[model samples]
Target: MIKKLLLGLLALLLCATAYLLLWPVPIQAQVWVAPPAPGYVGPHAPNTRLAGLQMISLGAEEGPEHVAMGPDGWLYTAVGSGKLLRMKPDGSELAVWAQTGGRVLGFDFDAQGRMIAADAMRGLLAISPSGEVSLLTDHVGDSPILYADAVVVAQSGEMFFTDASTRFGAKALGSTFEASVLDILEQSSTGRVLAYNPATRQTRLMAQGLSFANGIALSSDQSQLFVAETGRYRVWRISTAATGLDVRQASPQAQVLLDNLPGYPDNLMRGLNGKIWMGLVKPRNPKIDNMAGKPWLRELTLRLPRSTWPVPKAYGHVVAFSEQGQILADLQDPSGAYPEATAVTETPERLYVHSLHAPALGWRPNDLK
Candidate 1:
């Protein structure tokens, strides 16, 4: 009888512990998904009709962040080793164009064939076809460009770029995003967009109060510019026309073009077919998104090392969308291309993808009409 009584007490104690552990929590339990297999296909349906989704090696020794096509038909890309590489169309030969003082992020070639780059540590840079590097601007107004992220060239020679965050540099991007959630919970702003004039060699702030201003792309007509606000999961369109500018009477009033994306959007480029191609570093983990509503949870996640962090398998995709924000196709790592594909640029013959951690470049040849 004594043994039976002891067994009953033990069972009751276990039930009490379970109740205490789960009673205080109001949110649902987070579900963890396993990482994708070496050759995992995405859940989203592929637009098979849209061709040119293959992966080709770019022969880089380190991570490549962005790719741009020059007027000479050569592919220009920025690698994590702080070097710019110029590769032939077939990815056969490569030449180190310029070695910046820091990591290079985004780049675009001007009408004059000069390459303009947004270097994370060295600020804005200009590279000649002959591989000479020059520092363009380091600051806008009095604030230094903490993390110059992306750049675009206009027909008039004006350059637009994003200073991703004032709180963190490019080296700490992962941490910066984590900090952004905390700041958002506190309702703070720490990002900006700037413009540089080549003729006068002047840099000035064009927009402020951005969560994390990223890729900048001008509209086909040059009447407006789209700035990717990564932290807020949206793209903001800033007016460039005289009428819209005059009405705001301030830094361009940003209008949301797309919001609440399934993933964090990175480098954006205008496709040859007149669509916007965006690279998603990773998809939104619902647990992380929910935690972002709470500052403390966001802070804790940020402190965790990337290796220990629980990431969803549904991340990593290159999405193509129309100018009006219609999703055209969702291109994934069909051949297990890259772990973290960060940027995409289209040339007359192919589409190039840059990986953040992978040592090589991925390419898919275009379907000739």
Candidate 2:
């Protein structure tokens, strides 16, 4: 009986080894050199500024991942439920604005006062003030946008937005969060930026080859564009004039502004006083950095149980930077009372912070000095 059992155990071990080595995983991991993590220092030192966030109940809704001030003066946020929740800046009179039927990671008001949204599942959309949602463009030329992310509307009625990853479609992958994990692990850098012209009803590719392009904000004069590349932990500035361009290629019009951030950067929004705010959803995981060059290991990791995955712990952190790449503000809550800080919406009196999976909206008095 002992000999039989030993042979069975050996057979099981061999099968497990083969599965780990040769499983048909979703990602085709690419080898890359990860930048050394910059521990919280300099302008990114740890602080409790984001702690004690006054919570605003979303009732049964959760994950206010993107918050923005509507043209009509109410604060609006897109929840995981595909419902846009709107309320007073003080978190009162909460009401549903419009159900986009897709996850809107970012949105902005266009010249016509329409909400231009980058919906992860539905593609780019234009939502009228009266709550009617219309599809704008899901494909540019022969290629379809897989993950529509942050968007910024120009005064000329042109819309610039990010297609977060071409290989990982949010609709097919079950959720944006899950697709993002696969894309980042793959490191194929298929993310790109595109421009949509409402007049011509055409979408044009702007740039490409980003690991996971996330947030986007246009410069004051709308001459420059800032983008957050999440997996690489950096923000980039690309000129609006560049079309059909590869950001990976060195060019005067494109450059990295903030390099080697301490955490994974998410949404980017223009803030008060010429500042642009970015949130770090999770701190860097050393294990991930270590595996950056190990393509096979990443594939093997996928064969393991998800509970053994090296996902980092939650930490509330946000930073503000100038177009010149100067660190203007850094807020952190180490306790993570408010998790997955994705971005911030600033009003005169309240600083509304957005989270990816928090149960409610978080805010604090605009009392920062």
Candidate 3:
């Protein structure tokens, strides 16, 4: 009986090993070397500046991913519940501005004072002043806009946005978080940048081959578009007039503005004095980077318990940089009290911090000139 039990135990161990090593998974893992992440020092050193961030609660509606100001000066933000909310700058008179019935990850206003939104489930949308929601465009070529992450309306009535992934669209994959994980694990570079022309009512691809395109911002002169490619930890600058460009290749007109950021870059908001504010959602994980060259290992990791996945620990961080890619200031809270500091919107009086998973919007008094 003891001999039989030992043989059964060995068989079980072999089965477990086989399951871990040969299980079919969703991700098509790739091999690419990830740069070493720099430690938090200098301007990124630990500080309490963001520790005491004041909050404007959303009750059960959480995850203020992106915050914007309307032409009317009211504060606008998109929450996780597929609701667009508006509140006074002082956090008074909180009310629903519009309901898109789909999660809006990012949004911006057009020259005509219309609220243009990048809805992860609904594609590009234009929300009127009276709270009417309209779908702008959803498909490019034969492919639909899978994960519309961010939108920026240009002065010419044109719209530019980022499709975060093609392989695991939010509609097919069920959730942005799950889709992102698959895309990052695969690293197939299926993400792309696109543009919509209002007059023509047509959407066309601008650039392709990004791992996971996230935040977007127009240059001060409105001539260039700065995109945050999160999966690869870089920011790309592309010309508005350029079409069908590949960001991975060397080009003078379109190239990486910031490369190998220490953390996962989230959103881009134009701030004071020609500076663009960028949020770093989480610090880099060396273990994940080390596995970049080992595709099989990455696949095996996905087969493990989901909790064993190498998701980076939460660390509150944000930075400001110029169009030339010069990092101006870096703010950090290593304790991660604020949670997923995804972007920063600057007003003359304050700097509002946006998050991807916080129950409230975090803001602090702005003294930076």
Candidate 4:
């Protein structure tokens, strides 16, 4: 009986090994060296500045991912339920504005007061004042725009946005968070920035080859774009005139403003003064960085139990930087009462913090209330 049990155990071990090595995962893991982590030093050192953020209950709703002021002087946010919720600035008179039926990760008001949305599952959409949704563009040539992540309308009625990852479509892979994991782990860098002209009804590519392009904000003059390349932990400033630019290659048109960040960057929005705000969605995981050049190990990691994945700890962090890349404000909450603080929507009176999966909307007065 002891000999039989030993043989069975050996057979189980071999099967487990094979499963770990040969399982078919969504990602085709690629080998690339990740930049060394910057470990919360200098301007990014630990702080309690963002601690005890005041909350506004969404009642039954959650994940107020994108928060901003609409053209009608009302504060707006898109929850996980695909319902657009609008409330007065003081978080009063809450009402359901409209439902897109798809997640809107980022949005902006066009010159004509229409909301241009980068809908993760529904492509680029235009939502009229009466809450009617229309598809603007979802494909370029033969390929589909799988992940429309961010949108910013130009003065000339042109829209600029990001397609986070072409390989792992959010709808196809279940959720935005899940698809992002595959693309970042693979480092295939299929994300791209695109431009759409409302007049000609044309969609064209501006830049490509980003691991995961998350957020974008136009320059004051609209001459340049500040983009968050999430997987690389960097923010880039690319000229608007540069068409079909490859950010991986150093060019005068593309420059890395912030590099080797302490965490994975998320959304970018225009902040108070001449500053641009960015959110570090989650801090860097040392294990992920260590496995960056090890494609085989990365694949093996995917084979492990989901709970065993090396997900980073929640640490609320957001930064305000000048157009020149100077760090202006670094707010952090080590306790992480508000997880996944994505970015700040700054008004003259308050800084409304956005979260990817928080139960409530949080805000702090200019004086840090």
Candidate 5:
């Protein structure tokens, strides 16, 4: 009986090994050396500024991934339910502005007052003030805009946005959260940045080969573009005139403005007095970074249940920086009262906090000096 039990145990171990090594997963693992994560200290020191913010409930619909102020002086935010909600600056009189029938991760207003959105599932869209939605451009040449993320409109009326990943489009992957995990695990760097001209109706690729090009913002002069590459934990500054440039190949015009950030940076918003506010979605996970050099290990990790994955814990964090990469203010909530604080929109009265999975929109007084 003992001998038989030993043989059965050996067979089980073999089967487990085979399942890990030969499982047919969606991600095609790629090798890239991840820089060592700098755990929160110094400028990114932990705090409780985000712990007890006032919240505006969204009822069942939640996850305000991005929020912006319209020229009408109302606050507009895109929720997970594909509904664009408009509310007063004080978070009252909530009403549906429009629905995209798909997720809109980020949006900005064009010169004509049309709200241009980077919809993850539907591609780029333009929504008029009267709630008429139009498909701007779904494809750049033969390649479709996979994950149309954060967008910014130029003074020249051009639109620039980030395609978070080519391999895991939201339409195919079903969920932005799932697709993001897969792309980050694979580290294939299939992300790209593109530009569109409304006049000529032409779309062009500006830069490519980023792990996950998430947030986008143009410079004060509209000469340079700032992008947050989430998977690599860095922010890049790319020139608006750049065309077909490969940022991964160290394009001179495309420079790394901030390197080795302590967390995965999410959205970017211009604040008062030449300041830019960025949210850090999650603090870095040391385990994930340690396995960066081991491609096989990362693949094996994916084979495990997603709940068992080494995703970093949700720590509410947001920071304000200047054009020269100077850290102005850093806010944190180690208790994570408001999860996935994706971005911050500043007004004279209050600073609204956007989240990825919170039941409410949080806000604190714009009292940061």
Candidate 6:
């Protein structure tokens, strides 16, 4: 009789376990639907005209995350594993500009040719052409910058960049790793954009209450700044002369540029063609977006290894959008370029791309021009 009772209990436990595994829990739903149609095609086939496409190899070990062109025509790239490299138009490497001892994300050259870098661990940095490095600001107001993602130079030489997250720094954080899962579950605003003045050598908070501000780009007229909020899957615009530093007052009323991107965008750049080029780090997963509304599920997912997690692959892609926010073209990894490209910068003679997983710059020279 005792054995029969034990069998019955085992059956009951198995049924309960099966029910728990199959039951659907109530979670917040945020669906990012695909665009009605993709605006552009992937990279051109090999031996083609190569007019509108080019890819260069930075020759780094891990991955090149961002790229910027200097006034001298040298292409500079930030390889995430603490290295910065310069390459010529023909894809020949020039020199190792500087070493940040941390992951370097975005880079831009100031009017004086000084390179301003956004380091994920070191905050904002200025590196002279001679390779002298200076630390600008580690924190804005009282909060430390957790993930300094991208930087842009204005005509006036003011430096602007995005602190992608306040809760998770870049070195330890991955796109698959969601900070909004924690923030939304806890209810707080930790993301922000910061500015540094060369004359004052001081860093100040330009705007706040951001939800994972990832990429930054200045308008063609230099009168407005556009920032990408990764978590919110939208971009917000701020006035170049916007008012008070108070979080609420400084908040620039955001305008949604592109909603429901097929993937999450990393960095943004204003191209010579007057269009915006955005890097889609990895395609968004419906399961993960659904988890954003549930704290417990998010916490569990965060604990999993990034490699073992059920996230999308980093298929490198560059999306070009018109000034009116229409996607004009889509460039893919035709040469099996970078496994995961995070940033892109267009020069007069070439298009520079930075990847996140492999240490190399992918370049496709302007054969047409």
Task: Give the worst 10-residue stretch by lDDT in candidate 2.
Answer: 360-369
| lDDT tens readout by residue for model 4, 1-369 | 999999999999999999999989878899888888889999998999999999998989999989999989999998888888999988999889888888999999988788899999989999998888999999977779999999889898899999999999988976988988899999999999999999999888899999899999999999999999998999989898878898888889999999999999999999878989999999999999999889999989889998999999989999999999999999999988899999999998999999989988999997632
Ranking by lDDT: 2, 4, 5, 3, 1, 6
lDDT at 113, model 3 = 85
Q: Give candidate 1 misplaced runs (Cα > 4 Å).
A: 1-55, 58-60, 171-188, 241-252, 302-308, 334-337
Off by over 4 Å in 4: none
**Candidate 5's error at 224, in angstroms?**
0.3
Listed in order, each prediction's TM-score against the native is 0.77, 0.99, 0.97, 0.98, 0.98, 0.77
Please give, for residues 184-296, the per-residue lDDT of candidate 1 as tens digits: 33323467778899999988777777666788898898877887877666777886532213212344355778766666677888887777778767666656556544544
Cα-based lDDT at residue 7, candidate 2: 100
Residue pairs clashing in model 3 are none
Q: What is the C-alpha RMSD of each candidate to the true structure, in Å?
A: 7.8, 0.9, 1.2, 1.2, 1.1, 5.6
How much lDDT does each candidate structure score? 0.69, 0.93, 0.90, 0.91, 0.91, 0.66
lDDT of 2: 0.93
Tell me how far candidate 4 lies from the true structure as C-alpha RMSD in angstroms. Answer: 1.2
lDDT of 2 by residue, 1-369 (tens): 999999999999999889889989999999999988989999998899999999999999999999999888888899999898889877899999899888999999986778999999999999999989999999989998899999999988899999999999999887999999999999999999999999999999999989899999999999999999998999999999988888878988899999999999999999899989999999999999999999999999999999999999888999989999999889999998898999998877878899999999999888754
How does candidate 1 score on lDDT? 0.69
lDDT of 5 by residue, 1-369 (tens): 999999999999999999999998888788888887778788887789878999887766799999999988889999988899998888888999999989999999998899999999989999999999999899989999989999999999999999999999888888998888888889999899999999999999999989999998889999999999999999999999999999978777899998899999989998888889999999999999988888899889878988888878878999988888899999999988899998899988889998999999999998976
Score candidate 6 by lDDT.
0.66
* Candidate 3 similarity to native, TM-score: 0.97
Q: By TM-score, highest first, what's the ranking?
A: 2, 4, 5, 3, 6, 1
Global fold similarity of model 1 (TM-score): 0.77
| Candidate that beats the other on TM-score, 4 or 6, i.e. the better one | 4
**Which candidate has the highest lDDT of all?**
2
Model 3 misplacement above 4 A: none
Q: For model 1, how big is the CA root-mean-square deviation?
A: 7.8
